[model samples]
Target: MQGWRSSMEDVHCTLLKLDDKAWSQWSYFSIFDGHNGLDTARKCAEDFHRYLLKSFNEMLKHGEPIDGPLKSSQLDLILFRKTIKQTYFFMDEQLRKSKTQHDESGAVVITCLIGPEVIYFMNVGDARAILVSKTGQVLLSTHDHKTSDPDEQHRIAEKGGSIWDNRVEGQLAMTRVLGDFSMDKDLVPPDADIKEYTIHDTNNPLGFIVLACDGIWDVMSNKECAKFIVERMSRTQDLCKICDEVLEECLKRGSADNMTIYIIKFL
Candidate 1:
């Protein structure tokens, strides 16, 4: 839970202990990186968690069990995925209808929900999340949505958009994001890549989950970040100090963009 901003355009939220009575065991964390301004990022930090909780509650009302058991059926898993997707859309729609004008600004978002038996994540734009094993292996990581990606390029072209200088319409660098009303809605949709992982060996432990904006990723590889944490944890158990060291490392590596990193250790 440490962040360093080269500018004031980055925002983050952390719920080390979420207070939802229905899902008391869950915790939430997220990072929002604003491109043109900080309005969208600030708004997301303030409201996105509420939207996610609301979506989860709606699914619970429909008989989707999300608590008290470690085992989840296939149907329950599907319903959870749907709830996350709907929450992303719901947040974006709210941003669109906001009283503040955000035609030129937008944000990249990465959010994670940690439950007793599973960890769920949703990512949009270039921000990323990674799961590292105890042995310093990268088990999973989210992909960045950039114009240079073939799938993103194809989608943009299909929506009557062009990429030049590796930017959408030669302006925005990311292919997917929230807000940015100036970009074509179809080209820059608010769709997020949702994923979940079951925590199987809680006794032996899984490792760590690292959520960060592109600023850190641009300078450090996934393995490097994980190894850094592992080395620090071996000596001291100060997670906050480890995160601060990571931020300093990024700055030493000359990361010019606003930087944020959130680490969740499973051990």
Candidate 2:
């Protein structure tokens, strides 16, 4: 939802199946929260997945199973993580080389690659994601990359950057993001924070996962949003309506920015 924003700068991507062949069984979803303008986010929504698919397929050709917790040495797992990080950088580099001036703006991203037995989350800036258990317990949550984070502060400082008023150079709130070519590259990097979570549907079962922009996080705590959805799901099973209501709840609670949420259920 656009909420109170004068212009809607947010965009999203969802693919039930990433592609054919080995990728046919995988899924993808992501939120790109744009700042300054929508071009960066829109471009990411259209092209980011392609880079990911190409990278993953190349890894697959080498017999590195897409479904991992690879029993054969940990090289495969290490390579898997490396590939994810490289893809983010590659996307960023592509943007840096774009002929258009869209890179002047920026977009924070939270991307998920949902495989048969595991989920991979790659994020930058404040767009976040979380995976919940069957009983509504949050199994994992992404840490936002903002000025308030000491590590992020150090990262910027190491690059000769300064923070003023809790923003990078007092202009941007996030320490990392895609695009923003006008800023110091080391200060506002496009490096992604990647994570992995193994899915267990039998011994522990599964509940749902939530992915949203900082617009929602600005007013709602992780548990608050998760609890609201868990309780609401008991009363209704319509996921699409639930997503809309989640955005509405954020608006009513004083979120003034564009809001986007994705609720993926396993139970």
Candidate 3:
């Protein structure tokens, strides 16, 4: 639950909490990276949470008649991705008309749901999600979204945008995201792009999640952060304290963009 910004731009928003509702038992955590302005970032963060809840409710409505054949994993990913895409489209269209964001406007979103024995993750863009295990192992991490990937580069080129030095010139750092209406319209007939990821239990490991913006990740490696967290947890095992240390470490390492982290420990 810490946020550090570099210079004046690069906005980030985060939320961490334990949930005990009638629908499920889990802890929810999320990070939002707003590119154009903090106004959109703040609103995106608030709206995403609501969108998730609505998605779950919709699943319940559609799943009630399934009897014992209901599969949470299959349903969750499908519903979550659908909900996120719909939500992003709604906001992108509204922001284009409501705000002064003449430039492309959007945000990268990463989320984690820690359930009793598994973790569900979804991400769009470079913002990351990391998991640490009790045995001091780095279990799960997401790849960044950028032009380096051939698929990403192709998408950018198709949209009449160029990727330089791993950035979307004046738009973003990745090929996919939640908004960026101006850029979307220029590149396509309707000018919109939305993406999502669904990580099943097959590849997950036994570590806490290290969710942060590129500011921190840009300067560090997946293995390096994994070792750092493992070493810290071996001593204190207090997640909040570990978060503080990770933030400072990133600053000391000279991260120039905004640095924000959402650490989720499965206890």
Candidate that would win on lDDT: 2
- Identify the runs in model 1 with alpha carbons over 4 angstroms from their true place: 1-6, 64-75, 202-204
> What is the Cα-based TM-score of model 3?
0.77
Global local distance difference test of model 1: 0.83
Model 3: residues with Cα > 4 Å off, grouped in runs: 1-21, 65-81, 100-105, 169-171, 185-205
Which residue pairs in candidate 3 have backbone atoms (N, alpha carbon, C) closer than 3 angstroms, thus clashing? 105-180, 130-209, 130-210, 132-206, 132-207, 132-208, 133-206, 133-207, 184-191, 185-191
Query: 1 or 2, which is superior by lDDT?
Result: 2
- Structural similarity to truth (TM-score) of each candidate: 0.91, 0.93, 0.77
Scored by TM-score, the top model is: 2
**lDDT of each prediction vs. the true structure?**
0.83, 0.86, 0.62
How many steric clashes does model 1 contain? 0
Error of 1 at 165 (Å): 0.6
Estimate, for each residue in 75-139, the C-alpha lDDT of model 2 and write its tens digit: 37787888888888888888778737444778999988888777888899999998887777887
lDDT digits (tens) for residues 1-267 of candidate 1:
234544677799998656647666778999998888878898999999888877777777777455553234423778888778888778888888883653577999999888877788789999999998888888889989988799999988888999999889888889889888887878888899987877886543588899999989999999899899999989988889998999889889988788888888875
